[model samples]
Target: MNHPIGEQTVLITGAGRGLGAAIATAFAREGARVAINYRHSRNHAEALAASIGPQAAVYQADVSDAQAVQELVARVADELGPPTTLVHNALANFRFNGEARKHLDTLQWSDVAAQGEVAVGGLINALRALDEHFTTHQGGRVITVGTNLFHNPVVPYHDYTAAKAALMAMTRTAARELGPRGVTVNMVAGGLLRTTDASAATPEAVFDLIASQTPLGHVTTPEELADAVLFFASPWARAVTGQTLIVDGGLVCD
Candidate 1:
């Protein structure tokens, strides 16, 4: 049940920029054929595909939409072969400014639902589309992008954190169900990435404080976190599943 990284076809959702872009680069560097799935950021996605050479291509898809995901998988299969790895990195739109965020009192259920629709719903769509491919091949890998906020709750981003928490739960449940089919499901949770689009609005003081508290003495960069994701998809992780690997420089112990 060894899944070699170099030979895999990887589809990464929301890979046009930020942490998703970094993850796509990491996989391509390892010789994986990559499909960069983006809801917007078409220019950036195309540029990234070009930079990654022939093994990578840009695809536009709203991962939360079942029909769109079906079409996306078809396109990826036609262009890059049926994807053996799926990275759920698509994020719902939100700013990182804690002061500007809505607290529990003002945060509506729809706000949380929006994030859940992307986080949880996107994973469901991908799994359904890839089920046949995985079964035919007898193996596959599912890597989900999550935040460490659930463990540390440094800012208590209620909507975002809650949705990610649910995603983590779903990841484990999926692992249990898909394990017999040889599809391993796991999550990679990171702290506030150094400078992704989502974290750009975070004040410098906040970054400095997080860095000071981290055992590594610096905020984790998306590239660093992306490498951890690569490990999960590699052959070395064949026996691992239903787990969450926190990649925030030891900022939180889980």
Candidate 2:
């Protein structure tokens, strides 16, 4: 059976593990070559690339740095061909104590702005630098991992939520600007994931509460959210752009 995105190359940030790892694996399963991006988890990223076989490889760079990001994407293009698809899933946190909500004063505004700058800015650079290849190659796809927190602020982590809101806004406007050039942009926002290193600090009670609130009787898994990303990256979703797909197991109806 031929997968929808077969023979394509995908670049995913924060692919050392968790949702990023899931997204990379899903694309690999579809027979797309994958460039797994990581900051400090080089060993784990290499291991995953190996698991995905020869079509997968790892790239290391701190996406927050624009110069480094441009160099990173160029390296991927030289090695595996320009990525036809991109997934931005990297994040940096000041402090995430899931046991208790982070106090406003305790969290710095830069902590939040840094995320938007790194993740969203990095995406812009990748798209712009990779634009020529996409034009030459015909079309490209971009999917950004977002959070449901922006739509419903009930579980307020102001910094994280606010950054995602900004990311979403960027996605919509970028889609409009990039649409004419055969590039599409979209966002897949999920609720608290079931388990990931980033969420390791999350308290068990918080997890239980989220599970109880979801109509599906459980929180979404990283793989589940990855599936939504796959849709946007696949040819089946060629016309779908500037859209936000909420994959929270009905925890958030909006």
Off by over 4 Å in 2: 1-3, 94-96
lDDT of each: 0.95, 0.83
Give the clash total for candidate 2.
0
| lDDT of model 1, residue 143 | 98
Which candidate gets the maximum TM-score versus the true structure? 1
**Steric overlap count per candidate:** 0, 0
List candidate 1 stretches off by more than 4 Å.
Answer: none
Tens digit of lDDT per residue, candidate 2, span 1-254? 11268878888988988888998899888888999999898999999999999899898998877778788889999999877888988877533454465668788877677777766776776677677767776778888888888888766787778888888988999999888877889999998887888777788887899899899999899999998998898878888899999999998876
In TM-score terms, candidate 2 sits at 0.94
Query: By lDDT, who's the top model here?
Result: 1
